[model samples]
Target: MKTAKIHLILSCLFIFSILSCNQKKEQKIETTSISQPEMVLDLLDLQANNKLGKDTLVTIVNDPVYHKAKKYKAVSASLLVKTEIELNKIDSKNTKIVFECVDGYKPEMPLELFLNANPFLAFEDVDAPKGSKWEPILKEGNEMNAEPFYIVYPSISEKDSRYKWPYNLVKIYLEPLNKSTLELYPLKNKKLETGYTLFKNQCLTCHSINGIGGTMGPELNYPKSVTEYWKENELVNYIVNPASFRNKVKMPTLGITKQQSQEIVDYLKYMSENKKKI
Candidate 1:
């Protein structure tokens, strides 16, 4: 009788332990499933809006798509806002937003955005010169004017003023008139032709996109390969300050303003998306 009772007690304890362990494991998994996507999206949103936040740190684990992309010079990732809350928040902030990307596994320094409370409603970094500011401006009746903000990196020297890097930063400004403006001055073929004309006159000797142009540096047409993994803001940040990522990259800072860079980005996006033989 005593032996039978002892065995029964041992069996009950073992069953209870197993059930408790299983329950804890299940809870952990559920928590991770809910939290991981939100964290990733938040990081992307912060980068897209050029908003400075410390929550952007992400630990890279292996994913099949990321690994496969590593084989090629460029890789693309899908950006899905997993929850309604996340989607609503992003939508409320800016209607025109760029998705996040990264440049493979090369860890770049975190970009900073500081909000100034004084005469300028702008954001600046500590490294920029004193008194230089970036302001978010808009005409009174425009809704988008309240959405996107610009950053101005102060110039250290007179020559640097001509280069875009010192004042270059990713901007997510809303332009409600952009579409109508494009329609009024249709540049579907014209912009590329004109942009290319401008490129040849100004940039052909040193930089190349397709088969033509200079060979001093890597081609910008397939930036996804070179910066395939870079987040959208990181790419802009890199353009703003190349030395921030690479010490020996030879591309000179062209003093390209936020608007000019966007045009260049649009041109690049066009070429990459429509690689039709022309």
Candidate 2:
């Protein structure tokens, strides 16, 4: 009876030791996951170091910038991201991928959505003249090209506004998805959410209010709100079609209706009163 008790106790102790080690390993993994840092990729730095991975041929039909079907020497952006970032280490649903451009154009999309789609990073334009890597695109008589990098998706339609196609790309940032929403959301005036939503979806990428958005265009708030100087009616009209107000206008003719423009204007007026010195 004594010998039998010893054998059973020894087996129990062995099983307990295994369970304890497993529990410790799980705890360590959880800690590592919780402590993972934000992922930011410097595309130029990666290119200079030859760490951008393999380059492949990608064709973008109806290229939005070029406004024509074009081909490019590119790399798989999603794969590059996967290789550079440990997706398992981050909560993708709660995270976002922000594309920072040379002109300070920052556009972001949900990390989960970006990963699920076939996004490519185009490094060179295949159709450029033999001596040149990219052809100069004339916009507002300003010459530009998708040099260095341009994000494209072969499968996605150009009309899809949910996705952002940023050219002159420089950096990629992995941040909290709600980062902008938290900063720009109007908590005091819930009724003005429609206008706020319009501004967030359409205008925030190019313009900023109180310095919380892209600096590609002039700041709408802070030192003096655009609402303070420009007449409200004219401002609404200009928002709909900037070319109507000025020549060689850098702002594109966004297809926003007059009513939508007014809503955005209203939201800006609201923000004018709530300006934070940024």
Candidate 1 deviant stretches above 4 angstroms: 1-198, 222-229, 276-278
The reply for model 2, stretches above 4 Å from the true place, is 1-38
Candidate 2: worst-modelled 10 consecutive residues by lDDT: 29-38
Consecutive 10-residue window with the lowest summed lDDT within model 1: 69-78
lDDT (10s digit) by residue, model 1, range 70-146:
11111111112222223333322222222122211111111111111010112232222356332222223322211
- TM-score of candidate 1 to 2 decimals: 0.28
Global lDDT scores for all candidate models = 0.36, 0.88
C-alpha lDDT (0 to 100) for residue 277 of candidate 1: 34
lDDT of 2 by residue, 1-278 (tens): 99999999999999999999999999987776544343788999999999888988998889999999999999989998998878787778898898889998889899888888899999999999889999778887788888789999999999998788899999997887787788778889987889998888887888888787788988898889999999999999999999999988888898999999998888888888898987
**Quick one: how many clashes does candidate 2 have?**
0
